[model samples]
Target: MEKNKISVTSDNIFPIIKKFLYSDQEVFLRELVSNATDAVLKLKTIVELGNFDDFIDDFKIKIIIDKKNKSIHIIDNGIGMTKEEIKKYINQIAFSGAEEFIKKYKTSNIIGHFGLGFYSSFIVSNQVQIFTKSYKKNASSIFWSCDGSTNFIIKEIEKKNRGTKIVLFLNEESKEFLEYNRILKLLQKYCKFMPITISLSSIEDKEKETIINNINPAWKINPLQLSDKNYLNFYHELYSHQLDDPLFWIHLNIDHPFNLTGILFFPKIEKRIDIQKERIHLYQNQVYITDNLEGIVADFLSLLRGVIDSPDIPLNVSRSHLQSDPSVKNISKYITRKVADKLDSMFRNHRKDFQNKWENIKIIVEYGMISTENFFVKAIKFFIFSTVNNVYFTLDEFKEKIKETQKNKEGKIVFLYSSDKEKQYSYIKEAKDRNYEILILNSPISVHLIQKLEFSYKEICFVRVDSDHIDKLINHKKEDKCYSELSETEKKNLKNIISSNLMENYKFSIKLENLSKKDYPFLIIVPEFLRRIKEMNSIGKEFFEKDKEKYYQLIVNTNHIFMKKILKETCEKKREKMIQEVLNLTLLSQNLLHGKNLTLFISEKLENLTKK
Candidate 1:
């Protein structure tokens, strides 16, 4: 037996490991189980290469909890290290710095890049012991024991099995690990479907038995051998509580460039922002590393629910390594492309089903497109827009159909919209009369999104239903004459009467137009540009929020009997009060008449009529 002291820069090393090495104490189970899985995989490879002749193939991991002794043992049948090998790999910390370690072992098949994984045991265990005999011929068994401190002891021991057994003396504060059910749950979370079988102590009827895991997960098996039913069975096993099945799935199996195998599922995305971390699980050699994979995968891919197992990921600096690695970027892009391709294929093969799922999937696709430009370019081809009238069309299809009809006088395509059908019913009716199609962009993000599209596409415009007069929406040159023209004095008097009767908060300007008698005597035209600007201000656009320059036009039919009567009444010195009454009526019709001015107008008209 050989002994060597652990090389540390300071006596503070153990303190650092105890207090600051890992974020959560529960993560200790993950690290220990992950190390065990790696060991089992290595031994399997060795056996496959004929390095271990006549070796027992019953290589199953086992977790046993002894509540009475306040201990738990995680045992694995793997390539157990010899005493000398343990001296090098276990006793001495190999890598002092992350960058140096990554560089040194860039080509190595080593699973744990950082030596701190073993130290994670100290989180839950006051004392730990390892008993093992290497698979090498005539190799002597060894027992290594350590307290939470740096001090440790190693000696030769007699053991029959060629594997390792890690016995953790659970700390008083962490006796939860010694519970039969608790350790079983932890094992399920960290090593449920590892390459080698994992077993937890269980009871069959009245007799004690071992509950073994399903070693060959769906991703590890041959896809050709699995039927559609097989893949669906695995999906149900993964998400038992989810009521609805996934829209589609991508079986990710890549060996070259980087060994990564997993299934990415496209669950029904009802809400765009509901896409969050923890959906993607990161694993190293079938040992779960983390589910909070912000830096590892692109933000948009967080909407994808699945597992990703690859030993190539750097464990020393998980976040920084993921952010800087070119291979990770490539892999992320590939996954995104695969997801997009699957969606497009689904749409092509099954139109009815695709349409049903489109509403639920639109949010995710739109979010991805808006965030990543590469995804945007790809997703736009498959994106379908549904109209307020329950008609669905792609962006290209809609543009082709409406390019001529919706084109404004300025030669820009006007995409008319309405936020509230009831509030803007009058405007919508007038637009429909002029044969204009209206879209319902009621989503909170629609305002900003439409603006983005306007900038992205040339000669495209969007306007709210109540934004402008019906005739001005899609202006066409017409040669017909309008309502009877009014003199300058008549127009001025009409403007003054209405303006004086309206509220201070509301501005009204009168415009004379020749129209048929059936037309409204007064049409309230909320100016297009100012209305949009005000809407933007209300939604917290700092630039236009406080700008006081607002324009609204009170367009009155000059030939209408009510307007003619008001003008004649205004010309009379004693009848000016009656004209004010008529002007108040017009303001009330526009929902603008209120407060002191309206009350005074009513009083003055009553007093004039009484005197007459």
Candidate 2:
């Protein structure tokens, strides 16, 4: 037996590694298993290159848990280290054996680049032992052990297998690693799509081993060899808890500028505000790295779900998160372009099918258009607008269809939209009466998207259906001729009476208009600008929320019979009652009448009906 100190700059290396090496203590399993995978792949590559005649039929990794001993073993049948190789690779700190092997063989299959992954074992273990036998002929098996310090023991051991076994003796705080369910969950999370087969076995059930990884994941396979069913199956495998199948997916495979391969699925989003990010899992050579791909993926594209495996994606030393690199930006741009191309293809080739899935996928597409300029340029060809009547049209197509009639006096195209078809039913019906198409902009981010669209298409403006009356919404110059017949004094008196009865929390600007007799006597309209700012405040922008004053335009139709009767009535009490009833009706239509005001309105109506 030979004893030596680990060659490092500082004797405190072990404590630093144990305490601050990895973000999560559970990452020790990922690091150790990834090293095992690298070893197996190196041997496989060597065998495939005709460097070795001894071929192992079963190249598998087994994770053994011994609860009684509070130890876990990660064993792999791969290229193991002899005594000298162990000294060179294990004793030296930050000297990557995987890097050396890849340079020697010109192979890209090795996963480990940072030599420090092995030291992560110290994060959870008080002691670690390595029993390895080299595949070289006449090579002696080596035994190496370290006890959370610089001192290590190395000697020749009698072993029959040509592989490596890493045994970690758990520390007091890390006893949870010995539990069967705990280790199984870590394996499922980190090594679920490893290229080599991995199995888990506990001492309680040593006879039975459960396979924990998929040797051939969909992203690692050739795109041409996969069918739609295969893709769907893989999606279900990735997200087993999701009940609804994805509307569609983009198969991304590129090798030109940087290596990137993955499948991104567009899920059916029922609520845009509840959109779950971090669903896109990032991997480095099939080893799961992270799902929080903030810097590596565009913010809008995080709405997509799937796997992204790219050896070129630069990770920090711990491999826990991505580092800032130009390649990351390139990968993000490539993915955005790929998604845009896929959506364009779907829209062109399968119009009916794309239309069928548009409602479920519009949020993603709209968000992309709003956030990315290049994606917006490409998405405009496929990004569609759907009306309340279920008609779909591209932006250009819709512009052409409504160009003749929907233009305001300033010649800018007016796109009418209703956020709630039921709550704003009257406004939607009024627009439909004049042959104007009303779009359903009901998503939580619709306000933001509307601003983005207006900025993009400079000649167009989006107005909510309930934002104003149809005359003001479309802004036909001819409609301005209609005005109230009452004198200015009578109008002023009417405004004061109506304003005094309104809630103090809101401010109403009373306007008298000679609208159609068929229209309601009173119409409450929220100014478009104020309503948009308030809506934006509701969706997380608090800058505008400080105003606290709600504003509305109360348009009283002079041609309506109730208004004329109220103006001519001799009884002051009856006239006041009529005005109150009309104001209450308007407030109820806006869904703003509540508490005492709502109760009073209901009771007054009931009392009048009883008298009749």
Candidate 3:
């Protein structure tokens, strides 16, 4: 028999396997069992190639826990290694035996790529023994043993079948692996969808029976083969306690460019805004790698729950590849394109269903559009905007429907929006009075999206509800005459009275218009562009902050009855107390009165009402 030494000189290999091979200790079970499953698949490939003439039965992988023996065994009817192969593979730890084997049998469609997957046994086992018999005629069976140290033992052994069995002597810290229920739970998590059958030992009526894993998961099969009902049934299998059914599903399968297969489900989200990011699972050859897929998948796709298996995703030494790479970028772009195409197709074929899912799924689409420019251009056609009256319209459709009424002074299309309906109810009603539509821009991303839209589309602008009066929303070119009943002296006195009573941080400006007495007692008008910029800055928008001065215009109407009466009284008696009271009342109505002035105004009003 040939002999070989492990490649690395470091006696710290066991510690490396236990601590550095994977991020989570539980993943060791997945790595080891996945290795076994891959071995069975290679044996099946050899059988199909007709090189190994032995009669290979239906292959299966099995896990056996011996609680009394303090050991766990994983058995597989796969390609058993000969003595020479064992010396080259099992003896040489850190040497990628699987990579060399696949290179030798390059045309066999082998799945295992790295040999170190087996050394993961050291993560939970103090001692590991491997017994194997090759399919070659007259081949001798061999037993290999290692005790988590540099030393090992190998010799001939007795075995009936052409396969391999791994016996792991559980360490004191890893006694949990010997529990039947724990091993079963792990098998379900990591091996449920493996191509080969997997069995776990279970006792019924004190009789031990091997329970097999379900090999053909729904994702591996053709989606066309399964009816919609069958797909829904599989979704229930994945998440039963989840109350609502999925709004939609994406069956991802591709073989030519790179091996990838998955079934991603968009479950009915309760609050689309609070989308969780830990749902998508990344897998390599059916072995789950990690659920934190933020780097591998686009942020928007985090709303989806499912598995993404691909052999092409190159992992670092630790198996947890959080950093960005070319393959990950390609996958993310592909997913974003697929999602956009799926939504676009649904829009064309099934309008009603798309609408039904819009409220929940829109978050995904919106986030993607905002993040990816290409996705934005594609989805802008299907994105729906809702008005205050709960009417939905596509961007193009809405622009078309309101072109007659929403265009402004510069002939630009002005979209009026409000964040708080109750606070801006009067402004919204006034806009509606002039046959203008108000958009509900309640989302935190609205300002950013509006900015992007303004840059993307020419002659389009967004104005807040309280930005300006209704007459100024869509400009009328018919110039009106301006007449002030107050002389220049009266106007000067009125301005002084208004400025003296205004809040310290605020500036009060007076503008006279010949508006009818049917108008408000006093109207405050903030310029459209300035108000939007200020609103944007309040939300931490840097572009608005950079050019901050253009963010507001507080216009008070002097033509109103209250302002007229105040001006007349100020001229008649110069009664400073009455003028201050009236000016403070006007400031309070505009939500501007504050601090000492506000406190004094409230106290004086209370005293006057009490005396009356």
Top-scoring candidate (TM-score): 2
Residues 3-86, candidate 1: write the lDDT tens digits: 999766535677787778777787787767666766776676667667778657587787777766777778888878799877
RMSD of each: 6.6, 3.9, 5.3
Query: Which one wins by lDDT: 2 or 3?
Result: 2
For candidate 3, write residues 395-502 as lDDT tens digits.
888889888777888999988888778767778887887778888777656766788888988878888878776666667446542355667787677677666654
Candidate 2 lDDT by residue in tens digits, 1-612: 999997656476757866887989999999999999998998999899898998578999999999889899999999999899898888887789999998999988789997999999999898999999998899999999999898999999899999999999999999988888988999999999999999999988888788998889999889899999999999989998887778888888988888899999989885574648439898888898888988777788888899999999999999987889998899989998888889899999999999998888888887888888999899989988889998998889988888878987788999999988989999999999988998888887888889988998999999999987897778665744466667788777766656765546356677777787788989988788888987877643464444323466888887677766876777877776777777777778868687898998889778989994
- Candidate 1 Cα deviation (angstroms), residue 330: 1.9
Candidates' lDDT values, in order? 0.70, 0.86, 0.73
Provide the TM-score for each candidate, comma-separated: 0.80, 0.94, 0.83
Off by over 4 Å in 2: 1-10, 275-278, 477-480, 500-507, 539-549
**What would you estimate as the lDDT of candidate 2?**
0.86
Decoy 2 TM-score against native: 0.94
Candidate 1 shows a clash count of 3
- RMSD versus native structure for model 1: 6.6
In candidate 1, position 493 carries an lDDT of 79
Clashes of each: 3, 0, 1
Q: Pick the winner on lDDT between candidates 1 and 2.
A: 2
